[model samples]
Target chain A: MNPLLSSIFSTGFAFAILRVMTPLLFPALGVAVSELAGSVNIALEGIMLISAFFGVIVSAFTGSLFLALIAGLAAGILMGALLAYFHLKMKADIILGAIALNMFAAGMTIFLLFLFTGDKGSTSSLQSLVFPEIDIPLLKSIPVIGEIFSGHNVLTYVSLLAVPFFYVLMFKTPLGLRIRAVGQNPHAAESVGINVDRIKLYALMLSGMFGAFGGLYLSMGYVSWFSRDMTAGRGFIAIAAATLGGNMPVGILLSSLLFGFVNSIAIYIASLNVPSELIQMIPYLVTLIALAVFAIRAQRKRDKVGEVLEHFDPEAVKAVVKDVIETEGDI
Target chain B: MEKFILKYFTLIRTLIAILVGIIISVVLIYIISDMPAYSVRQFLLGPLLSRGRFANVIENASPMIFCGVAIAIAFQAKQFNIGAEGALFLSAAVGTAFAVSTGMPTVLHIILVLLVAGATGAIWGFIPGILKAKWGASELVASLMMNYIAYFGGLYIINSHFRDKDAGFLVSLRLPETAWLPQFMPGTRLHLGIFLAFIFAFLGYYFLYHTTSGYEIRTTGNNQKFARFSGINVVKVVILAQVLSGMIAGIGGMTEIMGIHRRFNWQMSPGYGWDGVIVAIIGRNHPILIIFAAFFLSYLRVGGQILNLMADVPSELVLVIQSVIIILITAEAFLSTWKNKITIKEAERVEVANESVAQ
Candidate 1:
């Protein structure tokens, strides 16, 4: 077998995919939540940045992992609330407000980083704690599966659990139902006495929490520092994943896994003769193609339905309507 | 008085927003800096202190002016295509490739290079535009994804094909003198691109306000279903707006390369594209006002740079101010009460005038 093929088939490669998928999974789920609430959070990138920065800073200073997590989550939720306030209360355009928040996050993080560590690029000088890895005893006894899944970062397990958590939260609960109702039709939700604004606010805050975990994983688990613009378009890529997945939990998980597989392959191939830049382009190009294909298929379906309606006979429809009316009168 | 207030309502609102942004930044500097007064002075007065610095403001504003106009046109059509960042980077690389390899007369060389750049950018914009117009895909997501692709794609081309091995860095060969944009000022980097930027702004204004196609674009943006009912081909308008916007952005990229850098060496997106979005928002997506907005932003940028050099303050502070201004300006309820009062006064005055005439 070719060396590249052998390397790809190894258990290590599967582990690599899982490791890479963690960040994308978290943000994609976040995107799904807000998208289902009809308030798509375009500021996921900024939220992630703020959380990543706060996580690193708080951990470095307090030496408490729990404090870091709380600070990071709080920062992310605050940003989500700020976006909601601007969009819902101030009547600002959600997209523009999100864009503003992104810029604010990018700038604020760098400014504070410089102020604290005297370095603008990253927090490499500070020593931040990471979430511990856990090994499942039963899983550890398995063969190739053990190598792929036994010992992994706690966040990785959390991300896997989040898929089901997302499903139950979005499908089973009343809040989830209200969120979906608000997303599908705000006026209808309002007419039913569902606090549309409050539900959306909760949805966005939930999104923030998920995005914060993704950011924390990046800084603490993936690497031990926060870097400038280090989310590196993952937040944007999560949007594509959510859209490609139809904004469903299971679908988002699958798409994120696909992106992760591609990302891992890109990393694997970087050692070959191919230029790294071209390799870097592959995932984004794949996303664009996926979006286009999904959209085209949807369009074709709509066109086929339209064609069916266009060919319907007026006399047949009128005859059916008269028969239904006559049957009702007889009853 | 009511008529005057109504006429200048937007201007008043925008001014207040800008003032609020400045005040917020001032408060931030005061809290952050030990030498608050000096830092504030440097931020406010540094851009006007010297001719070179003032010229830097103009030079910086030039590319942004083109981008602002491009964004204004696209946004007028209600297309949220933010691929200008990618389009500019990729087109600049292509333009540089042409500038380095081709041999031609100076004037013709510059024109041809610019045209090629514009065409390249149009292709970038067309992808998202067609996707959204034909398939109902989100232009926002498609365009955002395209930016990353454009960045890496441009980087690949430059690194593999155009890499000047002797330069010890990722950069192309020096552009030919014929392709260079001529300098306008003796002691500064100000170039002929500034004039082109101004020309493009005026042309954008004319195209948007004076042409039938412009009307179609605006109508489609204002109300898509209504435009369709009125016999407008909205799909065509949507795609046209994106392509035209991309072309302008492409030309802006070429000018930045030709006018300042003179090489294809940008390691990252230059961020002028995002600045253009800020400018467009500040100008309310109007072409003529974009020029002023571009200048205002560039002035702040120059001031930030000066403050950074003199007071150890990071220039990212300006970004904070810019975002604040954007959010405030776009907030519909920011000063709604004042606007409502002015409208009520106008209505009352009109009724009084009618009664007097009847008497």
Candidate 2:
């Protein structure tokens, strides 16, 4: 009944989906980079919050967008260093440490926010700068596709471009190969004189960098100011994106886009007089259903004795999908 | 002496972590405040400055114990469930609805509300448990996702079905006097819920250490495949443990609502579930230790709040310090390094004994 639902048929909807996907894509890419190296970053949510806070406060004080950006990224890397110190050096349980780091980020950012501007809920008092959306010169004159692609925040283009960049960095480079080797067989990699801890350190730091970009994009690009707990579990959603995508760069991009579409739908539904609370549940419910389907398909693969494939097999996947649909129909 | 020290090594490490956490927090206090000494005094002794303040610590720990025990039970079953927050909110809402809408004998009404909370919580938890058991879904994400759903769903329920017309807020109809938890202290907010929390902790300890089902849950947690090979119903144990965990969290939230507010309110459970995780980790997932950990955390919170009120320091500072303590306490490196030192010393002692025997 909502008029906004009709927008789904227009190019505006496509543009909105793309815009929504940009923030998720950056973190999902980071998750893919780290998880493929066998060190999952559960602190993405915390890292994002820290960066968003620092991005605004630092920009307010320095009055330089570049320096603020660097400071924000540094805050995320600092999270990685803390994780590495507790998880690697102190030998803490990695997930537990990550969770604690998240809490620390949540609390520290608010504490610092109060210190900077006497605001506990948000950084509305600060006059922080945001990145300008670039209208591509040649692309602006293109057909329907241009409307969906042009006039996005600078980070949006960078995020889409980083998909291929990550693909090559992960699949084509020696460091990538070494990271995979260390992950798959630490003993073997160590015997070959590859420093395992050093590689893990490198992976964590890189993961932190990309994770911070996603966070910085949220505060400095998506919104003009920072808000308390503004990440709203997007970091976890990014992990879901990475897992659904099988930790591949291209897969991450597509899955993030899929999630973006769902998120857009959730927003559109909000206009239909549905309570805002129920509307908020849509994005999460969609994620749960998608993950359930993924799990069921993985189970089916095990039953068929076709060990889980690294990439999609069209015929096999179609058969599985048909079988699931038929079984549900029967029930 | 050596045996005793070795037996309590984990405890010693946790104590050290807590001391370090406090010291770092004090240093931060010094940096943030002009009256460093006064700030430190408030942070340390503010909770005990008066009976009312000390009672605040007890009141805060009541719900914490509920959530802490909930997390401890689930963790012991090898299910990394973080859905207790959702379970708490939904269960409390359901319980409060039943309490406010229905009238019965006072004691019977309370019993019914508790049962409603526990049952609703179990259903909430069982969904993800069943998904994980049947389809191999990652319960962690499934449960985390479930929390958001529960949060929004609970809020919707309050807004549509239970809203108090004259209250002017999103809160629900207040429970009748029959549902109110009796206060032992006439003037304070301290209710029998604090005692109930202690009871839950003690029962949890007993259930974990003494029961056959507990052994099954523990084995499943330690190694699911091994437990299956040993004839334990691994799937059933996993689901059941989570159900029980949810029941505890539900009771916790209901207790807080009935005992503290006596009204249906749907706000998320004060991050008690997340705090539950930190306390459980600090307690090493032992039920008895979780009680102590909950006490310590709530004490820190009350003290921190007093400091926030007295000085310009934010109470959120305790969260930072709490995270530091948890990370340090759970670090396995200290245990491993200590074990290595003990092994080396034992080897030397054996060699010396061999030399003496030869002589």
Candidate 3:
């Protein structure tokens, strides 16, 4: 390959990663909010799965990408509400509810595939609305940054925009404080006049929006069509990213971008001289390693803090123990 | 008498949950599809109309019982081992691999395959266990990620190394007949896996409720600090739960393959581990209750298939219904009030009786 072409290829590879990571980012954000609120949204994978299908089907039928996006969002909220209802109201286990949603999504999507396109593994025949490209005229004039950021899918930009919004929601707003409070100490929040369950519900709803956007991107922006398990392990990757990023918006965006970068490289490598199977495993493998590293570091931090607090701050230790006890009683 | 009353109360509440679930399923079918009465009947009574189909229900329930109990065991230990799916997939592949490669006596070969499968699953589950124990990693995320690796990893192995060239499908070669699990019912799809599932559930009950280790595991699950205060090795207990849970899930995969498919294949499991997780919760991590929960789920599967054959209704409706049921049950609203009511009634009755005795 020519030197210039090789450089361009690498750049394109980098762009592909960005494209891939965009879909993963939103759901990860959703997972972050819900997890922070002490409600583990395991159904994110299922939500994305159904929403991807609905995004294409509704878009193709109506010839409106916006409508399809709305429909997808509705579908995600439905799943999220269903999950929250069971988890918060009916007292169902979070993981179990998620599992049911996953199974439901898997089967329903396949069934609908047969109902709509008569295909089991894919939905390629649908003339779905593709998200328009956002070309920043002024930004394009910039030298290095222009090429990197310009001419992307509309949802890609939205995903980027969501990061700051999530940060503000999680830290700046009363709702965000309530969500964090509910997650950290639900009883304390309850004592402070916060309805812990209600906070969780709101957090889950916000999460559904993020998850729905993820699904919309998969169908309308990333691929123009939906395939079975198309979001693949991205939902789980998002969960990993959420944890790796320490459940913060800025950290999540960076983690998601890094994952996207890894994904793009993996795709590029697979296109070249590489075994497709091994290449396929690359993204998941990276997630595993990244998560492991993040976890180890977090554990070390917790241990060090505990050690310092144990001797230096007896009152703080007592307060922490009391907080844990209160939380334990509530659970 | 107390045991009988407790069992009956459990049964009654379960039945009510099922009934409520049925009503919801009917409503969904009515809205999504067309027929109301027929679909409702099919959803409710479709599983018991035939012998073969009924057996199919039990057969499907078999692995779920294994996975559910396995999950329940871990849940009791307070270890969230979500890699039951991964464990099942990897173990199935290992079981099939051993069956093909090893030439031994019939009994030994079968036993060896099961053992190897269990070990593979245990190891797969053990990685996250060790991570959570030593590194403070979240098992939920780790196990979820590992599930994908194990799933596609098994697929890669089967497609590359064990691909049965003669078979057109993406599957491995058939195992030797000697390694096949015996059928529980002749001329039916049901196999000895059902018996094993029952044994595992009973054994799970005994192990969890009766053993010293079980007490330690339960304490560890209930509260780590408390367990630590009691001098229990919480980390070891949690890790053990994961490993043991994985072992059962591995055997679940083995029983599934050895009893049903006879070879490794892509789509080895259709979210059995996930279903097991739900079943575990619905059963409240109790062993015997898991049996009923598994049966209830299998009824839906078998009944859904029946509905598909008999009516124009899509069988995916069952999945939707099952999901709704699980969601409703887990939502906490449906059960919490009932729990509160029952608890309150018991308290009132006790106070009245004490007053009467004092008088």
Candidate 4:
């Protein structure tokens, strides 16, 4: 077999893909939740960093895994609330506020790290509580396929669980319906007595919760250590993955896996005869091309929307709405 | 006087926001430090106590002013281009590579190097802008993604072509003497690039206010549908603004390479791009005001560095202060509404008294 085919079929490579994709899945889900609610929280980068630092800090001092996890998620929620307060209460632009928060997170984490450990780098001095890996009852005993799927970090399974959890919450719950209604047609939703701002805030909170989970996984589950600015644009990579995936649960998983596979390949190819710089550029170049392709696809989709919009019957829509309103009144 | 106040409302509000930011920082310093009063005093008036420190502030502000102008220009056109960081690195690498590898007359060589750098940057920035104009891509995401690409691409070039094997570090070879920007003073690090930054700021102001193109860009930004209705090519404006923004950032990168290091260095960006975002916002996207904003930010940076060296303090306190100020200032409904409410109450009272006197 050729080297390319051999690499593709490698068992170790498959494991690396899942390991890398685990951290990304949470943030990708978070991005989906926020985008579904009409507010893009660009502060995922900062939120993950701050939460990761705090998670490790709490895990080290308390030596309690569960409390550290809660602290991480709480830190993310606090950042999310700050964004909501600025955008909702203070009337700051969401994008700009997010950028500010990101800068603050970068500076604050390092500053606090310095104060706590007296080290300007990674928090390696303190021993952090680790989230142990799990081996499936029957899967680990099987052949290569079982080896690929089992014996992963506990958070990997949590990330997998979150996808179904989000799918249900997004499509099967009343709050999810309200969020979708507000995101799609805010004026119509508001006219029906739905509180738009509250829904958006709740959506942002959920998004923050997912982001915090990702942060906790990075520090506590993935590697059991915290480093300054360790996320290293992984949050951005999550954004790219979410965007590429079309912001759906299944799509996000596939996209995360794709990017993770690409990332693993990038690492694998580093041992080749080519320059390391070229090796590093592989993932980013793919990301840029993917962006262009996504943009093109969206453009084509929008043009189709115009033709569909032209066929709208105003009177028929009014009758349908009236019938629904009459049924609601009867209820 | 009333018209003047209306004209400078953003400036006045910014000042108040900055004052509030400083007060909060003082409290933070008090909490974090053993000697709060001394630290606060040093933070406020530290740069002036030494000539070198003051020069350090000016030197640092040079790149900020250039990048700030670039951001302000892009923001004025509503492009929201955040790829200036990548554009800065790529253009400088291109400029320095050209300068070092070429053999030409002094002036022409420098001019060519600069032009190449600006064009590189403009092309680098135009990708996202054109994509947004033509296909309605999210400019923010496209620009940010482009940043990572540019960063890695620049590093690739530096390592492959410009590696100075004798430098004991992964940096580029020194450029020809023709490309080195002259120092403003014998001993200080301040160089001729600062004047270029000042000129660009003036150009930025003039470009936004005086030209017909400026009017078109602003109109397009303010209301795209209205601009289309008024026969302005909204798409072209969007693309052009980002192109210009990238070009300016690229030049800033080139100047930074020539002015400070006199060599092509591949050091990680000191985050001048992010700093420019705050500076542009603090200046309300105005040119002359951005110069002041950049200098003020640099002063705080120098003060923070001084404290870091003097008392083992982290320089990140400056960043916290900057983020708070940007957040508050950008929150128009936060402090401005209160200011307007007070002004309105005073006006109502005065009008009531005048009516009673007339009766």
Candidate 5:
């Protein structure tokens, strides 16, 4: 077997995919939440930057990981509240407001970075703490599964746990129902005494929380330093992930895993004779193709529904319409 | 006077937003800078103090004008196709291949390079446009993904085929003299691209406001369902808007390369496409207004550079100010009460005038 092929086939490669997918999963989950609320938080990019920056700064100065985590989460939630004020209260365009926040985060982080550390690129000089890795003793006893799942960073396990947590939160809770109702129809939600603005605010804040975790993982677990624009395009790619997943918990997990697999492959192939730039293009190109396929399928589904409607029996349609009007009148 | 104020309410609100943005920057400087007063002075006065510095403003604003108009055009048609960044990068690389390898008459060479650049950009725009039009894929995400693909793809082409090994950097061979845009001033890099930028802006204004297709684009943008009901082809209009936007962005890239760099050497996305968004927002998505917005943004950028060099302040401060202005100006309710008051006053005056005429 070829060396490259052998390397790819190992349990280590599966572990690499899981490791790479953690950050993406967090933000993609965030995107799904906010997108479900009908106010997409494109500023996950900025929120992640702020959280990552504050986490490093607080941890480095105070020497307390807990304090750093609090500070990071607080910063992200505050950004979400600011966006809510701008969009819901001030009637600003959500997209433009989010774009502004992204620019602010990109600028203010670098500006404060220089002010604190005298470095414009990264905080490599600071001795930031990394989150500890956990080994599942029972899982470690297994052969292939143990190698792939044991001794991973604590956040990676948390990310996996988050999927089920997200499913419960989105499906089983009253707040979740209200959020979905608000997303489906704001006027109807409002009429039922569900404060649309409040629900949206909650949704955005929840998104910020999830995005903050991703940022913390990037700065603390993935590497031991805070870097300028370190999120790169992962924040944007998460939007693609969320959309490709149809904004569902299980779907988001699968899509994020897919992206992680492609990204890890891109990383592995860099050692080959192929130009690294072309290899770098693969993940993004895959996203474009995936998006197109998703859109086409969705379109076909809609057309099929239209076809069904067109072919409906007139007598059955009339009976259903009359039944709905009678039921409304009785109400 | 009340009527005048009411008519220009949006303009007034925008001016106020800009003022607030400047004040925010000043406060930030005072808090952050050791020598606050000096930093503020350099930021406000540095660009206007020197002839050469002012030229930098013009040189910077030229490409911004092109991009601003491009953004304004696409935005007018309500297509959030941010692929201008990708189109600019990819087209510049393709244009450079022509600029470096081909030997032709100066005028013909320039035209050929620009046309190829525009066509390349159009293709970039067409992808997202058609996707959104046909299948409802979000143009915003599609275009953004395209930017990275273009960046890496362009880099691959440049690194593998066009890399000048002796240049000591990852750059293409120097552009030939035939390709350079004519410079207006001997000392300044201010080139004919500035005039071309102005021409393009005017043409964009004409195409968007005067032509039948422009009407269709605007009508579709204003209300897609209504436009469709009125017999307009919303799909075609959307695709056309993206393609035209990409073409304009492509030409802008060509101008930047032809006007400034001696060789094709952009290691990272230069971010002019993003700046064009700010320009379009500030200009309120109007072609003519975008020129002034470009000049204003370029002035601030130049000032930031000077402040960085002289006062030791990071120029990223300008980005903070730009974002604040964008958020405030786009907020519909920001100055709504004041606008309403002005409109009420104008209505009262009109009623009084009518009563007096009847008497």
Candidate 6:
């Protein structure tokens, strides 16, 4: 197994990790925006599912991959706005709204599959355009890093490029400030006439655009065709990445890479005659472990902060308790 | 009776939203697919044309009753135990394994499966509850993330351990006859689970609204600090709510498997855990109301399937309609003009009071 592992790295397993991570990286970036905006997009699964469906269908119909990408983006925008409308203006619970959208996407896509191709579960027969790999001849000639980075879809490059760009947009811009402000304290932002709702809406729309791009990568870029449940929890993994990264762009990138690495190894191990089902479960198992660990760490920090506050201002705690009781009577 | 009418106003709003949402969904379908014979009315009435389809609706709603009441219990305690999905799957897999492998009398077999399923689900739910209570983990994230772990982990077990060699599909071996639940409607698929659903609905109502423990759970949900001050262990209450919710969801899995499928199929549920969320909302977290909410949703699902079979329309339109209904119902401003009148009355009172005080 150790020899196999060493040979596996030499045999391009590391590069495979990057290629696998590319799909996850894009949506994780989108998830970062949504979570940072304080509206967790649980519909990422559905968005990616529908986008992958439409991306391949539209491309197959129009015979143009670019058009398919546009259609994918449009679908993502629609889902994002739908979720945002429900969560932001409608005051619907975020997770509930997301679950509805996800369910809708799942069932609708299957229904549409039956309507369009007369297939119950997949759309593999469509004449869709597959993305062309980028030819960085010089980069390809270079050593390990070049092998890892070169020869991918244009969308993959864009997803990678988004990491730094998103960092700048999230931290360095006025719009970013407004979004963070809304997430942290919408009341304060509203007091300052920040149009907090509008900021959240915009953030959600942008998140949709990125999520759709991730979907496009899955359909036209990776598989060249769409299958039912094609995204297969990649959207959820993106969400896990975003949260694990603490909703930071760079952190999301790193988290996506970690997930990608685990997924690639799982695939490799499954292919090597290890039980495929157990191997397939590895990524999800690892995600649960990672989430539990992260939750514990965060909980510890919160408890420590509470302890410090209690020691510093015992009277404030009593005041809070009194205020809570008063509020209780009103409810 | 007048108070009843007032209490039922929200129910009326729900009906109107359903109508509007169906209308919009039909319009979207007609525009996209160019079919007019397949209208919203067909979607509303298609399933009721036959007894078999009617039974299907009840069979579907049976699980909704369990999970919906489970969610209602958690909502009472203000614990969002979204892990019901995970709990349901774990129970189904474990219960099926036990049923298929065990050799026992019919009655004992059934009881054992239900008990084991409930306890397993409770353990699954308890993890997140304790995590939230002891470590302050966000129950929402913990529960939701745990769903995937449960799903994939269950898949691993199914593929390796429970794979039925003689069974044609990727499903478990059929349970013994002793483990099977008795059907209620003989020819129809409806089983004794419907009776269980009724019992659960009443039990949930009594447990949440009548019992002292129920009051504590609700009080904790309403105000944690206040509940703590009132000598209630808020943490214990939240954890108990999760356990109760999980047990109810576990029974749902047991009923679904033993009564309907007879085999453990992983994709048996089309996201019923999430649908339970909508039912809880429309029910206003009331147990009695859950029966109606679950029935309404199940009707839409069964009716939509019939409509799709009879007409050229896609069954997915029903889902779009359901999402719209949820959105419309949850919106603050979607209430009728009666709400506007109440707001205006409050405003006028404030204005007149100010005027009198000024003098």
Enumerate the chain B TM-scores of all models.
0.97, 0.96, 0.92, 0.95, 0.97, 0.90
TM-score for predicted model 1 compared with the true structure: 0.93
Native-to-model Cα distance after best TM-score fit, residue A181 in candidate 1, in Å: 3.0
Choose 4 or 5, whichever is better by lDDT.
Answer: 5
Chain A TM-score of each candidate structure, as shown = 0.88, 0.84, 0.85, 0.88, 0.89, 0.85
B77-148 per-residue lDDT for model 2 (tens digits):
888898999999888888888888899999998888899999999998898888888788878878888887
Q: After superposing candidate 4, which stretches have Cα over 4 Å from the reference?
A: A1-9, A304-331, B1-7, B353-358
Give candidate 6's error at residue B154 in angstroms. 2.1
lDDT of every model, 2 decimals = 0.90, 0.84, 0.80, 0.84, 0.89, 0.80
Q: Give the share of true interchain contacts found in each model.
A: 0.78, 0.76, 0.68, 0.66, 0.86, 0.47
Query: For candidate 4, lDDT tens digit of each residue in B122-168?
Result: 99879988999988888887888788778878877887788798999
Native-to-model Cα distance after best TM-score fit, residue A8 in candidate 1, in Å: 3.8
The lDDT of model 2 is 0.84
By TM-score, highest first, what's the ranking? 5, 1, 4, 2, 6, 3
Candidate 5 lDDT, B9-114, residue by residue in tens: 8898899999999999999899788999999999999999999999999999988888888888888888887889999999999888878899889999899989
Ranking by DockQ: 5, 1, 4, 2, 3, 6
Model 1 chain B — which ten-residue stretch has the worst lDDT? B307-316
Alpha-carbon error at A176 in model 2, in Å?
4.2
Candidate 3 docks with a DockQ of 0.47
- State the C-alpha RMSD over the true interface residues for candidate 5, after superposing those residues: 1.5
Ten contiguous residues minimizing lDDT sum, candidate 2 chain B: B1-10
How far off is residue A14 in model 4, in Å?
A: 2.4
* Candidate 5 Cα misplacement greater than 4 A, ranges: A10-13, A125-127, A141-144, A191-193, A307-331, B353-359
Query: What CA root-mean-square deviation does each model show from the true structure?
Result: 4.4, 5.1, 5.0, 4.3, 3.7, 5.9
Residue-wise lDDT of candidate 5 within A227-267, one digit each (tens)?
Answer: 99999878888997887787889989998998898788877
Candidate 3, B1-359: lDDT as tens digits: 33344446655555666677777667766765556678778767877777877888888999999999989988897777788998998889877887988788788888899999989988987888888888877788788778878876787777668879998777899999989988767878788888889999999999999998889899988888999999998788888888889999999989989889888865545678877887897687999999998998888877777767776566776777676666655555655566666767777877899999999
What is candidate 6's lDDT per residue for A1-331, written digit by digit as tens?
5755875676387777777888788788788787777777778888988888898889888988778878999999888988888887667777777877887787788777877897766778778887788967888888887777788777778888999889899889999888888877788889999998788888888888888888888888788888777887788788778867767778788888888877777766765656665555555566556667766765665555566576777786656546544643110
Worst 10 residues of 4 chain B by lDDT: B1-10
lDDT of 4 at B90: 89
Q: After superposition, how far is residue B347 of candidate 4 from its true place, in Å?
A: 3.2
